[model samples]
Every structure is written in C-alpha cells, then in structure tokens.
Target: MINISRRIQVNAQSEANGVSLNRSQVWEGLVSKARNAVPYVSAITECNIVEDQGDRFIREVVLHGERLQELVILSTEQQVEFVRLSGNARGIIKNVIEEENGELYLRFSFDFSLPGVPAGSEKELEFATGMQNSYLDAVRSTLQTIRNKVSQ
Candidate 1:
C-alpha cells in the first residue's frame, strides 16, 4: 500500500477570517453542493450525509473503480470543523483545518494499493495518476464555485 499526502496553506495571513464561511458552515452547505456535483465526482456512487455534530459531520461515500470495484468511505469534519471526503478515484481527502489568527490550512491524502509483482502494476499507476489529477481539479472547481457564490 502506498500513500500520497499533500498539505497546503490556503492563506497564511488572516486565513481564519479569510474563509467567508466557517468550517461547520462550509460542511453544511457542502452536502448540497456535493449532491449536485455527484455526476462530476469521478467515481463517487453516492454521498450520504450521516451525522452533523455542531462542529463536524460524517458522510458515507461509495467510490467505484475497475480494480477495486467499490470503496465505501467514512469521512469526517475535523479541526476547524472543515469537510473531509473520500472516494475510489482519490481515496481520502480532507479539506481546510486549523484556522489560526487569520491563516487557514488544507490537506489531501490518498492511499493506493500497489499491485504486488512487476513492482506495482502499470495499470494501477495509470489509474492513480488520472484520479490524482481529477481530485485536485475537482477541489479547485468546488472552491471557485464557492467563491463566486459568496462574491455575488
């Protein structure tokens, strides 16, 4: 099993206040947005809202792939109460977290199973690469949509 992790600081200064919507608030709206965006979720079968605990929430999302077929993910809203998500294409991805002063952070991590023999099958690598790019693009599009809505 090989894992890939990416952590970025969206805003290093005043990121806390920079996110027009609070973490929990984002989670609230995210559910609907995700539902509407399901078709674009790559391998997502469904995103079922499970729990909302004031500061955090949980969801069960099913991801599909040729090799794994389907992967059920349990995502949670973590620190800062930001949204967390998982799926087949990219595995698990966590959104913004740990707001301090005015700074905000975002992290996305994924776990990919490398087929043993032939040193990680070539097909697995191709899927991983495609999914990784798709995940990043999806996040960017989602954020841009949010920003546009807020600006209006």
Candidate 2:
C-alpha cells in the first residue's frame, strides 16, 4: 500500500479574497452540493446520507469510473471552529482554525492510502497518482471557491 499525506493551510498568509468565513459556513457549502462545488468529486454518482443530525453525519458515496468504491464518510463539526472528517478511502481530512497571537488560520490535512502495484508499473502508478492528485486538486479548488463566495 502507498500512503500519501498532504497538508493545505488557509490562513491570513494564504492568498484569499478579503472575506472571512467561519468553519461552519465552509462545511455547509462543502456538503450542500458536493458534486457541483467540487469538480473531481464528480466521480461520486450517488450520495446517501444515512445519518444526519446537528453536527454529525454518516454518508455513503458511490464512486464510478474504472473502479467502483463505496466510501462511507463520517463527519463532525466542533462548534463553529473546526470540522473533522474521515472516509473509507482515506484516513481523515481535518479542517481546523488556529488562533495564535490574535491571528486566525484555516488548515486542511488529507491522509490516505492507495493500493500499491509492482515497482516500475507505469500504468498502475499513473492511474493511482492521477486519481489521488485529482482529489487533492478538487479540495484546493473548492476552498478557493469558498473564499470567493464569502468575499462576494
């Protein structure tokens, strides 16, 4: 298995429009219309919210294409400050804010594991990397859109 962990930070130092949105607003926008908001996640043909309450949810997403994987995602919000999420496909993606010295910061960490193929397997690695990179890019793009929306 190949494990990939990536961290993306969205803080005052991050390039964003002059808009500040709490973690709740960001989480809402992310889940409300996931397919429309995130591009690469378009692979998710179906999403069933099995359990939905105030600050917690268990959602199953059916992914399509060359492979079919049902990702069961568990998500929880910590008040309005942060959100924690996990899925069968990945370890967890945590979106949290850090308040240090009167400065607010937003951060996202993605940790996941992928099936590994034999070394020097061009096709397999290519496909694996492509899918992983697409997911990562989608999140980054979504965050940019969120910032734009809040600015407007």
Candidate 3:
C-alpha cells in the first residue's frame, strides 16, 4: 500500500482578500463535498447520497470514470473520512481541519492500494505521484470553493 498526505493553509490566500474561512464554514464545505463532490472534485462527474445517518452517510460517486461507493463519516468540525467500499482504490481518505499559530489548515491524506499493482513497483510509484498531484489540486479547489461560498 502507498500512503499520500498533503495539507494547505485554508486562509493563506483568502486572508489577503479579507475572506478567511472559520471552522464552521470549512466543516460545512467538507460536508457539502461529501454529499456532492462534483463541484469540489473535477474528477468526480457524478455524486449521489445513497444513505444518510446523521453523522455518516453512504455515497456513490463517479470518479475518474469509475463508479465508486464510499462510506463517509463526519466528525463535527474536525474531520471527514471517506472509506472506499467498492472501487479501484481500497482504504480510507481523510479531510482534516487543523489549527496552528491561530491559522486554519486543511489536510488531505490517503491510505490505499491499487488492486493489481505491486507495492514496490515503478507503476505503483507513478500512480502514487499522479494521485498525489490530483488530490492536492482537489484540496485547493475545495478550499477555493469554500472561500467563494463564504464571500457570497
């Protein structure tokens, strides 16, 4: 399995524009992404909430042209976790909110393995690199979307 982790300061750019996102705003954005990721994730073409159970929900999303089902769990304003139920990747992906020196940060972490790829092969490394870049863009886009929402 390969693990990829990345984080970005949510208010880094927005603060200069006088639009910093608070904990609740970021949390709501995370929840919105969990429900309908089409806007936040460019790779996700479609999203549907299969089931809702207050703090957790099951969603089916078409990501990178592959239909995937995820069990999404919300941890109030702290974190949101997506566990892949059926997809090319297996394991969990997390979106976490952190505070440091009075600044807010959003962290995206992935722990998963491609079914047929060998752990220490070149192909795995390539996939990991590409996924890391793709996810980083997604995280940035998520924050930008939240900022736009907050400003409006």
Estimate, for each residue in 34-87, the C-alpha lDDT of model 1 and write its tens digit: 444454454665655565553345656655533222222224444222233433
Candidate 3, superposed: residue stretches over 4 Å from native: 14-16
Candidate 2 C-alpha error for residue 109, in Å: 6.4
- Lowest-scoring 10 consecutive residues by lDDT in candidate 2? 79-88
TM-score, model 3 to reference: 0.95
Q: Residue 75 of model 3: what lDDT? A: 94
For model 3, what is the error of residue 83's alpha carbon versus the real structure, in angstroms, after optimal superposition? Answer: 0.2
Alpha-carbon TM-score of each model against the true structure: 0.52, 0.53, 0.95
Over 4 Å off in model 2, which ranges?
12-14, 30-46, 50-75, 78-120, 148-152
User: Model 3: per-residue lDDT, tens digit, 11-124?
Assistant: 886443677888999999999999999999999999999999989999999999999899999999999999999987798999999999998889999998989988989998
Sort by lDDT, best first: what order? 3, 2, 1
Best by TM-score: 3
Instruction: Tell me the number of clashing residue pairs for each predicted model.
Output: 4, 0, 0
The residue-level lDDT of candidate 3 at 48 comes to 97
Q: What TM-score number comes out for model 1?
A: 0.52
- Residue 39's C-alpha lDDT in candidate 3? 90
